[model samples]
Target: MSGKQDCKTRYPLLLAHGLGVTEHGGLYVPWGRVPDVLRAHGAEVCFGGQDAWGSIETGAAQLAEAVRKIRHLYGCERVNIIAHSKGGLEARHLISAMGYGKYVASLTMLSTPNRGSRVAELLLHARPGVAVWARGNDAWWRQGGDKHPDALRAGEQLTPAYLEIFNRTHPDACCVYYQSWGARLGKHNTDAAMRLTHGLFYPAHGDSDGLVTPQSARWGRYRGTLTGVSHQQLVDAQGVDSGGFDVRGFYVRLVQELVQMGF
Candidate 1:
């Protein structure tokens, strides 16, 4: 009964990935094997093919187009967006600012920095040399899928000050049901790269899943955090041994929750 193909909801589901993660040629999905599992359980899943390093506005516009495609292709009225990290920001913007609330039934954000990231504040407050290095990094992102990959801009948006201001202008849509999920990777985390980040975020944010902290990700309905899942591990399987949270089972429960809620 749990993993059966009766997990269908009233609307189709769309998966949106975080920054620096692009879906090229539809060969690779951001959520790894999660999409196929959801489909097997009777969920019609789609992708929001936005640029990896695009600005929030750019991401929102791209999401609007993707939503339109989903509606037309599947003959559905609305979509339920499952966005991760920065994609959550874009998905929220689509519902709030781009008038896409009517087209969206719900938004389930997994590990999104809704309140903003602690490192983003550091980068913004750092010396001019760091800013220059960021520009060089932005150039690489620009070459990928970002027509305008301004790290400074992306950084600014992820800061507390900017998020506070952004929230005022782009409040949650009345028609859309919003909920968020967060994760944590402490100092003793398995992911080596995340362990370093965990140390950096210790003084400011305490516990984070490599990039975003638990406090920063608490937004909207505030779903609980994934105990062992890191930011990278949530989207990628990482070779053959991702030992934390069951990604496939997580989505099944999520969709099942939606189905129970009449979404």
Candidate 2:
């Protein structure tokens, strides 16, 4: 119950990042200082280490491997996954379709598009050169150490139509605790980089965190929304903040709650 041991969960915490992101480069990869903060609070933290841009199936395979490594390294049976964006989908796949439910203690998703995103639908059909662009991105990421980056299929899988079938095929694992949190940008200018995405995604989906809408982010226990937080700020990316939200403190409390739940 002390501050030093506030986030000491029974199992190690695995932080999973979303599409077009990796936790292997720079000073701050995906979760920028989040893992450090968790560790400071007596929690063991690791990364999913999935491809920067890959299909959910491939990402889930990588996550399963990551889980295996983490379990062996820590000599623990299960891990508490805290995934963001597309990483949440991959975690779900790993838990259900991949039959790794017993290895996962809980899943807490941040801004995941569990019900699919309208932005993906628009990107898939709105532009004629979308496929071409995806192919280019795949090639680039492959050179960056991705063995099977499938940008086209990755984007396709995020569409509502595809996920409707995906949901049927991949139901939630009964053994794992699942919860999700949505983020809401107070305005388009909440994060300058998110302005364009906010402009495009807001028209049809209503309240959103620049990319995923609140409706699409709803899944599992639905842990409410983070007001004035952009998608980037959700992970403390680029050291940006919205409405003075304490990004690190938010995660500290999140992990503390998980510990309190005896995860």
Single out the weakest 10-residue window by summed lDDT for candidate 2: 24-33
Task: Report the lDDT tens digits of candidate 2 across residue range 15-110.
Answer: 999988888752235788788778888999999988888899999999999999999999999999999999999999999998999999999999
TM-score of 1: 0.90
Scored by CA lDDT, what does every candidate get? 0.80, 0.87
Winner by lDDT: 2
How many residue-pair clashes does candidate 1 contain?
Answer: 0
CA error at residue 178 for candidate 1, angstroms? 1.0
Q: Candidate 1 — which residues are off by over 4 angstroms? A: 1-4, 25-29, 186-188, 237-244
Point out where model 2 deviates above 4 Å.
Answer: 1-3, 25-28
Poorest 10 consecutive residues by lDDT, candidate 1: 20-29
